[model samples]
Target: MSREKLLEVQDLKQHFRTGKHSVVKAVDGITFDIYKGETFGLVGESGCGKSTTGRSIIRLYNATDGDVKFRGVSVHGKKSKDDLRIFNQKMQMIFQDPYASLNPRMTVMDIVAEGLDINNLAKTPKERQARVHELLETVGLSKEHANRYPHEFSGGQRQRIGIARALAVDPEFIIADEPISALDVSIQAQVVNLLKDLQDKHGYTYLFIAHDLSMVKYISDRIGVMYFGKMVEIAESDELYKNPLHPYTKSLLSAIPLPDPDYERTRRRVEYDPERDNDKSEEPVFREVKEGHWVLCTSKEFEQYKEDLVE
Candidate 1:
């Protein structure tokens, strides 16, 4: 992957106000970069703001605070219609639920060609049909299925349709918000492999959001661990897995099941109770505990991590 940054999310926060006047901190101040041609995995438990982060960067939700930059252009900032149109075409998203993401009223071709239609990428009806057909084949769907409704397909096939739609605009970046979570375990691999192959062919960057750590490890070049709307740690995939710094990161890694039966039985899971565990007085600062590895911690923890490296 190139060292050039494709997207930069700086101190992003998304808050929702409840009827009771309480603010829900869906995504509170997380920062990271996705390098060009690399999959940046964001992993955490349910409701940890993984999807919110993806949506915020893609401008699906207006960010409450902070900046999202794509190729030096502010994503959430006001822009001319032409610039916004370019932004819309360059960035795309794939939702978690395949069944719900596609419109039942539309055929697979119409759904896949939605982006092309909106962007006026195709001029003629024949061109649109050919483009849709090409996208379907690219995602491993048959041309015969192009006229079929989403209800007629299985979960995995529906997701393949979603992928085809995301690729319709020829996006350079894709925010995959838990793309495989709703699919069957057996079919999940196929979808993931399809994504990997597509990336290989197209060199697209990804913000792959998921709670499934194992699958994230398989697909991600680098991984960022999230907990309760905060980024706990980030590092290269194997480095983060082998040397998890934060308590939250360690706890998350411990939950990943081992393939060996003996190890699985003997492994002790790390428990994380944020209330009793993390210091709530001061806000956590992300520091480089090692080169290319960052951990959110107080000054004391940073020193401790430094000392541990020496020892």
Candidate 2:
């Protein structure tokens, strides 16, 4: 990973009005940065706002507060259509559900060429077709499948098509929201390998959102842990795995399936009590306990975390 910053999400929040006087804080005051050409993994259980964080960064959901900066430009709101177009061109998303994301009415070519069409990137029909064909090849598909609809392909192939669509405009960043979660166990590795190959070739920065901790560790240089709409820990992958600081993180690591049957049988799962773990009086802020490692904790908790690391 390079030292250059690509995307910065500062205290980002996404709140939804569910009723007359009630608001659901889907994401509350989360902060992290995606470095240039690095895959930053965001991991958490479902309903922890990992998907919301991805959507907010891509402007699918306008953040209710705080700012998301892409290469130092604000992405939240009130941008001109032209500016938004540029933002869309620069950053793209590969949604979790291939079935829901692809248009059954549209052919693979049309779906893949959607971004190009929106940005007016191609000059002619032939150019668009050529671009679509190229993108299909890029994602391990072929021109022969261009005329087919979404329903015709398998889950993995449909996801490849989604990857193709995200790459149509040569985007600098891609928000892959649980891209592999819907696929078979065998196919998951293939999709992830494809992403890694693409990143190596094109130097694409990724916000890889998933609940799969082991997969995240394999793909991401750095990982951030989220819980109940809050970012609890952020660190280099190996560092986080070897020395997880937060109670929630320890519990999460404990749950990861070990390779050995002996170890698995003997391993004890660390039970996390959210009410017991988090202090209500003073909200914790993310503090760096060591170089390149961050954890959210109150002042007293920070000292304890530091001491724990030392021990």
Candidate 3:
């Protein structure tokens, strides 16, 4: 991973007022950085605010607090229409649901060319058509499919179209929000591999948000674990899996099932009860227990983690 930061999210918070008195903190005070030309995977269970983080960063929803910066420019506050347009061109997002994200009324050509049209990337109609076709092919779809509506395509094909649409603007940073989660098991690997191949060819930076740890490990240079709208751990992909420091992280890693029958039978699930594990006396803070490995813990727990690592 490059030392250069492409995107920086500091203390980002997104809260929703569900009722007059009740509020939901979808994302609360999370901080992380995505290095240029590297895939940073954000993993957590559903409702853990991983997806919310992506949406807030993309400016789909206004954050309640904190800041998000792209190459040193703040994305949260107000900007001119021209500036917003430039940010939109540089940063694109792939939504979780292929069926819902795509327009049922529009043809694949129109859908993929939407970005091109908005940004005026292509001057002529012929140029636009050619660019759409090229993007379709890049995502493993045929030129013939351009005339078809989103409803005609299968889940995997629809996702490819979504990817094509995102690529239309040639974005430098892509936020893939559970891009493969809705696909079939067999199709999931194909989509993930396609994303990896595209990143490799284009040198695109990614904030890959997903629940699948194994796939995250395969694609990401660095990984962050989130729980209850807060980041619990952050480390290099292999390091996080090998030496998970947080209870929640351990619980998540332990749940991944192996193919072997013997291993499956012997596998133990670690249940993390926050009420039990979390020390009430001291507020937990994100701290580095080892070089490049950070975890949210109280000072006492931080010392314990470091000592345990030494043994």
Ranking by TM-score: 3, 2, 1
Whole-model Cα lDDT per candidate?
A: 0.92, 0.94, 0.94
Across 75-95, the per-residue lDDT of candidate 3 in tens digits comes to 988899999999999999999
Candidate 3 CA-lDDT value: 0.94
Model 2 TM-score relative to the real fold: 0.96
On a 0 to 1 TM-score scale, where does candidate 1 land against the true structure?
A: 0.96
| Model 1 accuracy (lDDT, Cα) | 0.92
Lowest summed lDDT across 10 adjacent residues in model 3 is found at 302-311
* TM-score per candidate: 0.96, 0.96, 0.98
lDDT of 1 at 162: 98
Question: What order do you get sorting by lDDT, best first?
Answer: 3, 2, 1
Kindly list the per-residue Cα lDDT of model 1 for residues 1-311, writing each as its tens digit: 43998999999999999968799999999999999999999999999998999989988899999999999889996789998889989999999999899999999989999999999999999999999999999999989999999999999999999999999999999999999999989999999999999999999888999998999999999999888888989999988877777888878888989789999989999998877777776877999999889999888888877776531
- Model 1 residue 237 CA deviation (Å) reads 0.4
Predicted candidate 2 versus true structure: per-residue lDDT over 182-257, tens digit per residue: 9999999999999999999999999999998999999999999999999999999999998899999999889999
RMSD score of candidate 2 (Å): 1.6
lDDT of 3 at 311: 26
lDDT of model 1 at residue 226? 88
Task: Give the lowest summed-lDDT range of ten residues in model 1.
Answer: 302-311
Question: Better model by lDDT, 1 or 3?
Answer: 3
